[model samples]
Target: MLWDWGYALEILPVLGQAAIITIEATLLGFAMAAVLGLVFAILRMLGPAVAWPVSMLIELVRSTPLLIQIFFLYFVLPKFGVTLDAFTAGVLALGLHYATYCAEVYRAGLENIPRGQWEASIALNLSLYTTFKDIILPQAIPPVVPPLGNYLVALFKETPLLSAIAVLELMQTAKILGSETFRYVEPITLVGALFLAMSLVSAALIRQVERALGRRFVR
Candidate 1:
């Protein structure tokens, strides 16, 4: 009665499906964050006119709570006739919220590059695109991979918040299972185990990436 193995087995498939949704949202959201972060970082480097506004936007996002942002996207946006489904709203919220932190990470990476590198590129008459693509990003991005990977793991954990908007991620699925069977222990414990397993796997992958980058850049 304390723990129903049979019930846990029965619910495993459903939870697995829901876990896939969580993973999908995390991946999609992190991809958006990575791209947007890089763009924001690059734009901020352009001039005071660009950097000031971009800095304010990044600060605004970082200062606010992600749950409120999620609610605004899912609940309030419908009032403006720009409606999004629960999953889309959740993924967007996650992406936008995390992108601010990622922007800071990228900015730090870019700033760490030596001033001489920029001068060298300019002296060589390299186009801005060529400078960044061939020289700057190759140096800036590798150093930031570990931090970006940390954000990826952090974003994955945040997927449980999607339940607030009925996105039916892992936590929401566990909650539904608990309510239906009146058995909270098995479902909730399993959800914790699943999250832990996934986090460890993600950490391992991040380390592998770091090693590979180290080798590539070591010359």
Candidate 2:
């Protein structure tokens, strides 16, 4: 059969559970990536001494394949007296891998802030923290939200990689179902639909946020 609604319906609950896992990993990993990326960007902007090291680290991460990073975190870390469960390892690997991209996005946004703003902050005797918190980040972060949202969607799709370490996410569930029943159509199609639906929803939400930020900053 080209399609089987009954099997699709029957397998949905399992996939639903797996979908929750995928969502969890995406959210936690994206949060880590966002924060870590911001830190990386800030360090790079601090001075040449800090920038050089952080720049090289970001380059190293960006130069490497994410699958290798994931494998290293899951399979290799344990030998060094550091061990993580599949879910934790997956989250860390995803976060660290994408952080390089997020760092560049953040750097672009930061660089877009006018030099006059920095000089004005200094003239007003604003502390470095105050300058960044009150003036710079507020201006920088909003413009970058759309790109970060794109990363969120990309990270959601990347959750399939978690299955490599047995995190039991959506794609893994589909693979198991296909293997057991020897019918790939229903399970695979449903998984694809789920991903599509979630991606569209995420994009819509991102657009909404962008509009809200535009209105707020425009005021």
Candidate 3:
């Protein structure tokens, strides 16, 4: 078998296109995580009556493997007559799986907030909405961004699992190319490089956000 640079270059175009699928799944999943995490965080903060169910759900999701969740969504939903495309199923599973972790991140951020701040909110007669939005969220969210971003990057890496359901992504493209060509070295190595490059780029961007938050946090 020839170790072919031409072979590697040829597959890049196909992998480049499939990388979009990975990115879309990652971003959409993060979007869901961000919102659901916030909701869970706030619900928990309010009181046990409001918090217990969401907390239980977070635990349930966290205890389950993401691969299992993805498989269930892809295979089981059809029984209920709910149809989902591979991309949607992949993203939804990724989102739901990560939301549990994101909720914990949010919980940590909220906990890091000074008890004095809550006392201050209480003393001021500020409405709950105003108190959370104006004070707690502003303080909590910035610190949580880096952690959340890391989860998003994790989600990005997990997109390869979508191949199980035939959602075309970078790794899937590599598999296809390898199957057709019988040369895995080039295609598989390209997939690794793509994941590394994307993860590095995303980490750098998140570092910027973290630095910006640092300035605000210190002030």
Per-prediction TM-score, please?
A: 0.98, 0.97, 0.94
Residue 180 lDDT in candidate 1: 88
> What C-alpha lDDT do the candidate models reach, one value each?
0.95, 0.93, 0.88
lDDT per residue as tens, model 2, 62-86: 9988888999999999999899999
Q: Please report, as a residue range, the 10-residue window in candidate 1 with the lowest summed lDDT.
A: 1-10
In model 2, the worst 10-residue window by lDDT is: 158-167
Q: Candidate 3 lDDT, tens digit per residue, 23-72? A: 98889998998888888878888888988888888888899888899989
Lowest summed lDDT across 10 adjacent residues in model 3 is found at: 1-10
Model 3, residue 13: distance off in Å is 0.6
Error of 1 at 64 (Å): 0.9
Candidate 2's displacement at residue 181, Å, is 1.9
* Whole-structure CA lDDT of model 3: 0.88
Q: Relative to the unseen true structure, what is the C-alpha lDDT of residue 179 in candidate 3, on a scale of 0 to 100?
A: 92
Q: Could you give candidate 1's per-residue lDDT for residues 1-219 as a string of tens digits? A: 788899889989999999999999999999999999999999999999999999998988899999999999999999999999999999999999888899989999999999999999999999999999999999999999999999999999999999999899999999988898788999999999999999999999999999999999888
Per-residue lDDT of 57 in model 1: 89
What stretches of model 2 exceed 4 Å from their correct place?
Answer: none
For every model shown, the clashing-pair count is 0, 0, 0
Instruction: Identify the superior model by lDDT, candidate 1 or candidate 2.
Output: 1
